[model samples]
Target chain A: MVVLTVLSLAMWLLTVHDANFSRMGQLGLVSILGWTYFVGLVLVTMGFANELLRTPLRKTWLLVFVLLLALYIFGTGSAVEPIASLPDSYRHAGLLEFIFQNGYARPHYVADFSWPGAFSLGSVFVAFAGQTNALGFTRWFPFFIELLYLAPLIVIVRSIGVGRRAAWFGIALFYTTDWIEQDYFSPQALGYFYLLVIMAAVFATWRAKPSPLFAGLRKNLHFRMARSRRALQLSRLKERGADPSPGTEPTSLSVFDSWRPRLVSAAKARRPKLVSVFDSWRLKPNPPIFGTQVVIQRRYVHGRVASLFARLEGRDTTKSLNTVQTLGVLGLLVLIMFALAMSHELTPYALILMLAGCLISRHLGRPELLAVAVLLALGWLSLGASDYWLGHLSDIFGGFGQIGSTLTDNVANRIAGSSVHQFAVNIRIYIILGIYLLAGVGVLRRATDSRVLEVVAVAPFFLLVVSSYVGEGLLRVVLYALPFTSLLAASAILPQQSGLIRSWLPDFRIFRYGRSSHTVIWTLVFSIVLASALATTVARGGNDDYESFTKGELDAVNYVYNHVTPGATVGTISPYLPFNQRSVGSVYWVSLYTSGSPTIKEITTGLLQIHAQYVVLSQSQENWGEIVAGFPKGWESRVFLSLATHGFHVVAAWPTASVLQVDPKIAKKG
Target chain B: MSGFLVASAASLSTSPAELIVMVVDFLLLSIRACSGVLGLRLTSRDSRILTSATVFFVALFIVLVVVRFKSLG
Candidate 1:
């Protein structure tokens, strides 16, 4: 019940915020003033009502009130237009195009480029159902994926005999961290989930009882020794009896008793008797053969020292074997990591560490040492060999003047070379990677109980101090990596201290609230409300007017498409439309369509070889000057004027740029 | 030429690399099949299939080279 209430309230808050109540005219004012008063009154009334009912009715009532408030908020907010929003980088050009075009099948050309077009299809299948887009689906995808990642973690926690609630807390804390949020939207999340599954399996096997092979061998060895001893004892008993009968011998109990005394005498005569308190406690009828030898040697210290040496050697040998095994595991893991890193995908370093740790613990008997070694290896490789560390170091240790110059140059280059959109993409990737690496390390530290936390905590501090060594961007990356590391440390420290606090203060209400599922529900609700509120705020802000395509360029492109024979060449200054239209002719400067590239000649030659009949010059978002400059000298002036006068013949002109057509002969020569 | 002959002789005494690869592949397949069977049984009994599967794979790998080889070979 408490959980439901908290969730409902959180949802209400999110909705209210999203609605931008403050910006609304009469309706917004009424909502803010009227709902606030009603909510306050309901809360006060619920307290008294609960007392009257002799139950905690306040929470239920409060939840109902919050729900009502959310309804009003949503009703007003829905009247406003939804802000025209672009999809996230990965979602926008790639997945969004696939979803819009193919309707979940192998359809093409939703975007200017094909790479994202391919990748986006998969994401569309995951995010949407058929042609319908549902908010519920989007909201719940993250939770389901998170639960999948937690399955192995729960197994590991259970293996250690931790309570279900504690395991849930640990897993929940991991999923809720900022790092998970960053990776949740990417393929890297799948890799991390798989790693967890593998680790859980290894840990379970490690803790299993001795294998059937070992058990069978032991049983056979024991059986043979027992049989031999029984036969020898029987022969002695028969001799002692001295029955002298043909078929049977009479066994004498006295012979066996006297045998013990003789053995004792023989042992005493051969070696000096040593007495100790522990001797009385020893449950042996006769001293062991090894003990007798020790007495004869009269070298107690020598025995002790030799045994110690044997133990040391045994441990050393075991460590050596473990080192070899760990190296094999590490090799496999490094390959996995390199593949992920090279792909610009998120790496599940935490899951890898936990798995390797558990495997060492179960099979090799020294998980901690193996974990430390693997960590040391990773640190060396990443810091010593990887450019990331070197760049960071250079920025930090280098003088202030150098750092300033580096920062200035980077900013200048970005401004000169790229658009705001491109800069945004770079920032997003860096932030995501920083969050992922930090969070991964945190999760690993929690799972393995390793000192990775210490290293991670100090990492940011070190980076901050060393910022002069590389470039200005190093500082930003360090800043992003720090908060995540600190959050992980806090998560690790909290559970240990929560119990102590509960015991000392002993506030029943507080304890009950903390233990209740209310917090989780409320958090979910709050997030929904916040998102809606933000959406409303943006919507109320107002809209911009801009045509996505210009009339003149669109006309020209349409003309070329209609007139040009199928499979005949057509050249367009607009590289995007050619790819979109699936034109048979040369698409001039294909390289410009993607992020900046250096192979200008290669792109041009490929275009010309295709026998493009129509050359298009678009004054679109792309640099038209650069495209024209690449054209042959003679055709340049004519092409430029033809585009300006007859641009209307072009197929499409986006709000930002115009498109132009080129003669077929110009394409053939080029 | 002598070194090549000696190396060829050594190689002929042992199995080819491809054969080793095939053996590894077969071993892994068998282990996976065995674990799958155990997992199905565990599911019916309300026990965790994951635990049973983990144990099965580890046991298969550890004992295969030593005990399984002695018997199968």
Candidate 2:
């Protein structure tokens, strides 16, 4: 494992060294990344999968491999890029600089300042680090934030009560499939971090204790609903027949030979008729393992220190805490939730839904947590961030129950950039669908004590109904659900079919590889892990063509920022330039592509209309024009020529970017 | 009404009311959290007291928000 880790790390370093940002094509950073990167990714993924399959799982080794895989997937972009990949990252830095200089957020200046927790803290960090701006933090924030997610993700995967191997596999799968680019330098990233910690604390400290409210609700529905009636009858019949225990060894035979004898016996024991379709659709009784309390044992300081020195440690998934310690954790979670409420607009609502799901599934002990989350989120939106929605109430509430339009806008419209980009988008859709499919199988096929994971996994999808989050609602939903969904997906590959769906589906236990099964399970897992990682690499970097900036482009933008006066409008054909890192509110920006593909006359008219003092024509903007907007080749050059004819001239030029300033005389004439 | 709401939202930037509300809310939240640990059991009548206090605080918080909206109005 160590050798494989070292080899993969070395290969990653080589890939990073070999990468040239100048060569990045329409497909993004992956275009410039060579074979070494892919090879390294496969090596680390294979190592993690192999370790998971081994008995008495090596915790330290698996940790090393997973971290290595994280670096390969999340860190490579930062290491290879000349600057940060996204313009929003630098714009966030600009906001941080604003706070750093002013010592407070500019309320009502922008929507971001309305929820200013992340930027305010970032300002303090910048000052403490003796930096004037947050540009240093922007370059590698994705990698850093992902590493921060690991601690909470670990606790979450462990406390969900999946098998040790499946838990670890889920962690690996989560990192590999996390292609969503929200981990950039933003409030959403920090809010997501807080969300994960809250989930971990909740999962680790509490066990499902059935509430009378839900139980009574279930009882009323059981008598009132037809499906519930079938489910009740099926539950009674399943309870009467065959012992739903793992002790029943799986046999290698046809479906009839393996399952019929049990069905025949169950039929004889009960009525002599087979289960009807409605009965088969009903849920079977939960096995004893399903509802068992998962105790997360508390760790003492000395024990943690001792374990640090220990060479090999067994699985320590159970986090045990006494009442006082649990209270402390809960207090901290509340603080984090409050901060989350103040930081991001959407995460608090997502957290509220997730906590509601936990309450419904009986995973949470106290329902007050949900109430408090709702209050804080609503209070902040109404009181603290009133500046954001004061005149835009319709923008916030307009998309209510518009799930179909949200899907069309988020999914269908995004799939039309270019052939390569469309392929990346399609593969991303397929990967998400595949994960959800596997999660569905795991929910149906695996025996579990609690359905908390399934409930929490599906909870974030409700965010889709509110589509006003800049069209990124679906992405955020998938990201928030990925950790639990990944665990459920892992269970599909290694299902515990002890008491779950014994008759409706073929016994996957035959492939559990106790004695008769071969390497098929491992092969399936390996293939899925590798394919997901490869697909994620394509999807994650698919936008790099315009998202990533070169050193020359950054320099050109900095030159413009240094020279341009306040209140001046900067124009670009696309929002792909790495500007907006200074004079944020005073210096405005306009994108020409918002009105779709512009002719030379339209470009000239648009720039003149905005009175843009400086216009940036960069390689990334050119890439966006060609790839995403389907503009003709060298369209930017023709636009520049037309601009020159209208008295805009090149003030500065770089290898990959150029800046043009409109003459004051020409601007006045226009 | 929209103009009034916008003016009230704009006032939030200059007025210290929003800060005062947030600080007080945080203090109240701390109290609520600590009450759970200071020998108040959820199954006891004391829990009803806690629940009532929580409800009152929430109502007061909402009122404070409304006051922020209406104070300038």
Candidate 3:
């Protein structure tokens, strides 16, 4: 496995070295990636599959394979591209530069300024490193941030009560299915990391312990339900063939049984057991599970919480932190939550929803922890981000309950780009739906004592129903749910069938592959994961045709930034170039195709109207026009020609990027 | 909230709005501290004191947050 991993890494290095960014198509980097890249991916996939399918899972080999896979998925863009891929990353760097220079975030400049924790931290790093700006970090931020996510991800997977193999597979599946491109050099990425850390700490240190009052209520409810089931002859119907008819007496009620006999006897008597049902619930000794028996359980959580906990309680034997360690973890979690609240706008809300789900399913102890998170999030928004909400209250509350439109904006509007981009978008949607479908299967097949994972996996969807989060709500919610959803999806292939709810679906003994059932299952898992990884490779990098900038383009942007005075206006046909790394608030940026593509006359008129001093026309902006906005292939050239004829002149030009400045006489006339 | 305080101070600007934010923020910090202490599994006396502190500070925080909301409106 180690040798395979090393070979894969070497292959990746060769592929990146041989790759040419100039030949990228609308399908993005995957269009240009060579056979060596594919070979590297296959090697890593084979290594991981081998590690996962074997007994007594080798942790070291599995981790190496997983890290190699992460590198292939996340590091390729940074290595293959001449510069950072996204314009937003450069904008974030510009924000960090501003904060480092001024020691403050300039409110009213951009909404992100109001939540400046991430930029401030980046500023501190830049100052400490004696660097002028954060531009250098932007190139490899995705790879670094994804690696940071691995630690918490491991803790979360292990602590969730999925078997060891399922946990490991889930981690790998998470990397492959993570096509959501939010892991840039941005606040949301760091905020997400903080969220994962908090969840890991919670799952590692806490177990569900019901209050005395709730315990008594649950006990009485269970006893009454048992009586009712007996009265209805449900138990007799379920255990029809298992009757002790020969001459022997019935055994005692077994706590581990799907149906306890004490409750059964009480139901037969029908009076005193109903009376002692009011007695406090007591802990029963742990026992082994009966073979392959499906447990019929109530789905509603109101009265069934105790039995639910009883059935699932000992599955999570991983959490063994003593009181002091637990308390210390709680403190660290609160501090992280505070930082998260100050860093990003939406993640704190996501955390609150997830924590609430945990509290509901009894995965989290200390109810006050949830309240603290809520207060911290709300309090920070109301206070720290006051400038953002003071005048834009409608932006905060207007989208509430508009689920239909939110879906349209997030899903429908995204699928209308170029044919290639449309295909990528469709594959992204299918990948999400596929993971979710597998998770549904896992939920029905896996035996578990608690509903914590299900609750958490479903909880993030509520964020979508409430607000569109400026049209990225669906993406954010999917990201928040991906870890748990991946774990559940893994359970579809490797379910641990010995818990509270053994299996909702009846078994058909379909694993008739003779002694090769394990091989069959492993093959199914590998095929599914490899297919998803291939699809995700395209889906994740599909936008790179326009999003990834070239060195010439970066130099073009830097040339404009260095020449333009403060408060000067810079014009572009689209907002796809790497132009926002300097003079953020002082310089104004006007893009003609910001909302919609326009004619050459419109571009010329708009530039003259804004009295723009310099306009940058780059290959990326042209690609955006043709590929995304459906403009003519050479429209930018025509627009540049019209501008040059009217007032603009080419001051400097690169192979793929060019800068045009308005003639001084024409500017004076305007 | 501590992050907010440090960031706000580093900006070297303050106003009545900021003061109102500080009041609510301090109350939130107090509630958070009390909640943390209560989670420590302390002696009965300390637990009682912390519980009382949490409730009191939570109430104060709620009032201040509401007031600030009103002022913003």
Candidate 4:
């Protein structure tokens, strides 16, 4: 633990020293994170698990503090004070300022203003802080938001009936593997907090006791299957169910010979080699393994954890709620849902999907809660966000069902950068695939548990089948699914008690590699957690080199704000720079994506048309053009040269940015 | 009521994303209602019938939304 703390501080120091906005590399991380950081991480994971298992509540406060600081150091540590990793953070600050000064959302300025709850909240926060804008709070926003999530995370984990060790493992893994970067200051980030809080509150207040309907069904199925077993030579489950013991193994080869799966190994062997990496989780028919080493591997720990849940329940399990308490909780959920509906365009949908999953799984006791979420979300989609989607209806459905294209947009195109960036992308893809694979194993392996957590984990993927939000919907879905996936992944090694379905077990080849000892399994689980945590730490900051801006660029834009007239139209090749942080509505902010990706001629015409007085070009714009828009590398230089040569002249040039004054002859259009 | 449903369907730009959300929402509601019926937890046969009728309308809405989205696309 001490070593890990030192390493985290070291990484923070290095990032502060070396990170800047010149090179578009992996996650803007300076080159301080190396093998030593990973080694320290492995130690940390080992120590954390050991501490948790030995004493569930011992030193947990310290654990939370250390993990949060490490995550902050890895995510946005290099950033200048009051600024964050992405330019979007600054734009968010601008939106808050617009709301603060104007007192209402301004539609059509940005799609964000259309759903203005988060910005309004930020406005409120800044006013409370006696600050002009949210700029004073943006830098630590991600850290604070992530910290806010830890409490609800514990409650959600408790709902799964896991032990303290498994819950801690799940929480740690969630922080470790989360690379979606949505935790930054945005609507989705706050929406995420609301979603978690609502889920936790619902689980605590409304969870129903386990009923025996499935048990009766499983009993009937068991009787029918056992009667057919004599004729069919099926691996008889009578002994397994009656005994509830792992040592009672199969006596003969006849039981094993009788089991022929619907997905026969022969047919599975014929699958194309290219899908080998995903072969383990290839949506095939796989049944539970009873009385084999797997039963021994999984069921024994179940009894132990069964006792652990009483302790794991923390002070907040679901109990009988009176009318007043129920109403209070319901009101709170409604308020959060309304803010979420008005704040984010996508997370409301994600929340509805999860609630719908809970309803289908019978985990949700209140159907009205699900209805509330759906009505709120759909209502907002039809009203609050109509302006955004009405014009962008094509964008909403443009990438529908285009899995290959969406994957390419999210993954393939991003992999085509510098060697370091390519390596970082590969690592990211590997870690993502690896974690899902572990989660898939957990789902299949724990089939007897009704797979409630697994079902919730999968509920959001349906959103991807219809629309990809410029490839970001998939990322947000992944982000929203991360907590559930982390819980499911923890269950892979943390053996769980079987539900009624455990009686219908199939052949048990999957458990061939199971270990009988608890200590060994603990080691293996912690090792997996640590390795993933280390790789995620590296990948999170790999692109920090170019994505984050320096003080010089901010200073140049600050100079523009100090000098330029209030009504001046400021332009850029792309939406970069800190220009719009002040004068919200008075200054016209134009960029290529918002005004239709324009040609050089269109840019000149548009600049003259708007009578643009000030223009700023910075490194972040150059990086966006090169990486996202496929503007050939160094095209920014040619465009800037042309601008300087023609009408725009350099007024205040910083090392990382330039402020240009447009020719005075172009008169302002009416 | 059916005419009102038809009119509501006609008024909006039924993109694939919208259709999918509509379909998912209806299906989940139907599943929840069906769980209640199948569990023998519904108050009466009238409640069961109402749930079944909702399922019917949900299915109909899904088909209409899909067809509209397809034709538009």
Candidate 5:
């Protein structure tokens, strides 16, 4: 109770700063603060003592009370600061400025060069606020988004029999992760949360039994009638003088009938017995169990393989396979792939042949042979072709190509003036990728059943290909591969092991460890470790550097908002600026806008038509310089160019690299 | 008349809007229960409405308090 109250108060104080203090709304502030503290205490106490609360109504009331308290705290804090006076660095600055000037608005611009892009729920929320000018929308909005992302992870852990404390730990790790932090200010992060929520909801529905409504709809009325007719037929057959058992020989039944009564009587006589002889003869046991058939088949196949190897080697091969063959195969594959990928002219044919030789040496079955052939064929076709058909194939099978493109782009950019540590980062990425790929293969090799191995192998390859395509970077491919590989490796190592090593891995016992409670401790530990590693790597790699750039953009936007007329549309050279500014205008500068659909052109033109008074260009060293150089001859004679040449002045410049300026005509128009 | 007066006092203690929402929530809950008993499945809208009604009552209570304080001031 104290913690919740303290946190709420702290957040409120941090957000409002001295805005409320200066306003002399001390009485209002005190009232709100007191209510917030009081309500927090009440809700916390109720939540803690929820088990003692007999009725569901009481528990619900407590939840509602907490929500209301949170609302009050947030609302009061939000109300303290005038929208116009808020710092430019704050996210949604343009929307806030619009709200201050126009009362309320929803977000308008859809597509932008922001993290997570515009086609997300977070962007929707931002757009809503910008378009509607509803200041109240900001309150409790982040919490809802966070809840959406967190709920899936919690449910997944619980479904896997993870304990409460561990689940909470995982949730906390998720909240504190770089992804969540990044999402806090950007609309794209919010979209990712929504995507996760949608996936979780789908998963939940899949896990549960079909909904009654769906079941009823699926159970055809005609089918029910037909079932009844069949039942009637069965009953009529029993009533007749014909044999009741369909498709059974009467002689077989008669033969068993002589012993049937004695068997029945003996079973009846032993009914009180705890262990009846007949119990063993029962067709199936109760306590219905569920397990993947694929896994069972894999285990069966593994047992067979172990036996075969034992016969071949004239000893138990388990220990030898685990220590020697596992490492050897993994190392060999990594070495082969690395060598092949690095070489400029390692023909797809040669690679496929090498893979085939490996498969043949491994004594893999015909199915494995066919699969490898197919994969190699696809790779070959992708590399050989350049036409449209080949392009499609290349797109599908061009993971390595994608990585090469990213490497080239990054390296070229670095060479052109960007400060990036390529070698160290790329190496780490490649190592992770190598490990991930090897782990997938290891899982396939070690899987007891061929079917299980096939299933696991196929999915990982698909994910690898898709991720590589989407990311278009070796580092990204490696990063994504890390989790998939870790999961597979962890599953393989822990399940069959015993004693000391088993203690180290995650499972029912290790997850619980020494704790008496039902918590899956190891899962929490794993999640935290993974999330921390990811966060550290992202931070080290300078992913957060984009935030600084965004800040500069926002500063430019603030200048425009302060100086330009309310209805005047502004044109910006950068797609990001226009999107972030929610400025509708004829954006002639960026390729993204120029090549966009008619709807985009319409939206852009609408902003300009409204009263676009300013044209601003951010002067970056690279692209910005090119844009400036491309300024058509005699451009200064034109009205727009003349305004820039004569009346426009740089308002703010960032480290003297980028400059934001205002046009004189904008002031005149206002 | 005494019973009616007691009922009116109880109702008055609750905000009119909140009480109305609570009654609606109660009715929805009862209907849902009855449907379950009759082996009839509730639609998504029914579930959403029931949930929304419960939420609405709580929201109404908070709104009432805010309105009352504002009016008093």
Candidate 6:
């Protein structure tokens, strides 16, 4: 708690007070201050860890989560002084404003209009609170959404059977490292909350029967065939006038004779097929399953794969749902699924994948849950989302299995620009790699009871195989997989138990340290938590180097919104300005808005042809060109020159943004 | 409730007077999500609420299909 509180206070003091900290000169006062913040963060995390390991209470962990969330999620945005950091938040607030004033989305316009649930929710929240705008909520939404994830996170970790200490620590680590920044005022945030709740609720409420569907069907089929064979034998015996009484079971000789042909056929089927290549795996009882559970874990070598899976995952062995509770949860599931289908594009699909994973793992009793998720996802995509996809079918299949490209977009591409930004990006990459490395170890260590859960954990990755969600797909897959991965990773420090690693890997002296010296272990964990928190805070807010707008920029945008006629076109070099606050009809960001790498001539011609009445040239727009689109360093100046030559004169100017007006009479002179 | 649902399907930012109705409509979505989890209790048999929810979802499915087909044709 102290660690988080200090981190929050220090963040507020350093970042909010030191406006030029991120862009400060090498080894300057601001740089010194930045270093101080990083060092302080590490020390505090260590202190928190020391306290957490000593205390017997789980509430300590929860308190730590809350505090870390405030410091990392909330503090990152709040530290940007008065204005909200991201330009998108301003647009979203405007979207809410428009919804409140107009009562519906402006369709056939704006990509976000198609997925209107989040905006509509914001409208209602602002109204219910009796506020006029969503600006207040927009600034601190990431914090609120992260806060909402607490209950479901706890339930999922515990259900996954991570030891209590491991669960708590892993969760803390997760909070510190989550730098995706998707928890903004967006549909995916709400959809994520729904997804977590549904998964955890399924875990808490019920489990499938010991006999899985496919296994039961197979057994029934075999029983019917055996019964027919026995009946045929009895008829043959009766015809021969031999005693084939019900009291007497089949003699060994008869049984051997009956099995001889089948045994010969089985041997013949297996005789020559065992080649040298896949010989080891050929006989390995691979899980050839379709929603069927096997009892014996390959390692355990004692029981059925179904029983093994059920036995290992403690949550998967719970009792069936009763009448009343069953009704309530199922009802809740439907409501959530519907809301998810409406609110977010990718989350419901993720939900479908995870639900199927649960059913395949025998964690869910009803096939109906999976069916509902599938139907809702497919129906929404095909019907509800037809409005978005009808004219843009190509958009759905743009990035298919381009792993290298996706990785570059999420990691490599982000490393360009300032050293501080590059450092933050590198840190984000390290923390992600760090957790998965531990999860790999945990899997070997038998961190969770059932190995099948690992398969379940990877289910969301299926989405990445085909679509990269327009470049950020892999990151989204990682986010969905975070809770499960964290659970497995936490098992690294999981006390000396029957871990998969412990069973397979011969005892190593290094693992002994995991079971000893609570003080040392906890202190190490605290350091990790602190490092991740620091990285996430830096990475999450690092976009402020460009994406953030100053008060003057917002004022310039407001001026455009108020002074210009409603239908007059407003243009920006990039969609990085907070200009769409009015949800007006004539907002046009240059070709660079939706497309990558617009040339200077293209920008000039596009704005000139549209006869854009007003244009914004902002620092963010320029930075976006340089870092993202590889525009020349003097692109901003060149754009200014182009506008000046095209009958455009500056109306208002600010350090961060400038508003320009184009005169039609003067434009003819150009 | 139906009126609110219908209102949610349209653009509300054009007029402020309808904000209250749209806001109420938004709350309906929240209420539907929150109530099920809060009211849920584990049972032996598929519960009565499950039946109601199934029927509700089936109805939702039909509504979506109808709306889509109507628009498509």
**DockQ for all models, in order?**
0.04, 0.14, 0.22, 0.09, 0.01, 0.06
Per-residue lDDT tens digits for candidate 5, residues B1-73, read 1212333344355335544543454444344334544566756556546546645544554465345334432
Model 4 residue B65 CA deviation (Å) reads: 11
In model 5, how large is the Cα lDDT of residue A386?
A: 16
The DockQ-based CAPRI class assigned to model 3 is incorrect
Tell me the lDDT of candidate 2. Answer: 0.74
At residue A434, candidate 6 shows an lDDT of 86
Clashes of each: 57, 10, 1, 9, 28, 40
lDDT at residue A564 of model 6 (Cα atoms): 80
Instruction: Estimate the lDDT of model 1.
Output: 0.35
Candidate 5 lDDT, tens digit per residue, A189-267?
Answer: 3434433332232222212211111222234545533443344344335556555565534433432334334434433
lDDT (Cα, tens digit) per residue for candidate 4, span B12-71: 553445555555655555444345444645443554465455445445554654454445
For residues A502-610, what per-residue lDDT tens digits would candidate 2 score against the true structure?
3134665556745355368778778988888888888899889888889899998888888888988889878887777888788898877742566778777877788
Model 4 chain A poorest 10 in a row by lDDT: A307-316
> What tens-digit string does per-residue lDDT give for candidate 6 at A223-253?
5345434543554466568887666544433
Model 6, stretches more than 4 Å misplaced?
A: A1-15, A18-36, A207-317, A398-424, A499-503, A507-515, A589-602, A629-635, A667-670, B1-73
TM-score of chain A of each: 0.35, 0.83, 0.87, 0.76, 0.37, 0.78
In terms of DockQ, the best-performing candidate is 3
Higher-scoring candidate on lDDT, 3 or 5: 3
Tens-place lDDT per residue, model 3, A180-205, is: 98999999999999999999988877
Instruction: Output the better candidate (4/5) by DockQ.
Output: 4
Preferred candidate (TM-score higher): 1 or 4:
4
Q: Considering every candidate listed, which one attains the maximal TM-score?
A: 3
Candidate 4 residues A358-404, lDDT tens each?
66554565555666576567655554565566656677777767888
Order the candidate numbers by DockQ, best to worst.
Answer: 3, 2, 4, 6, 1, 5
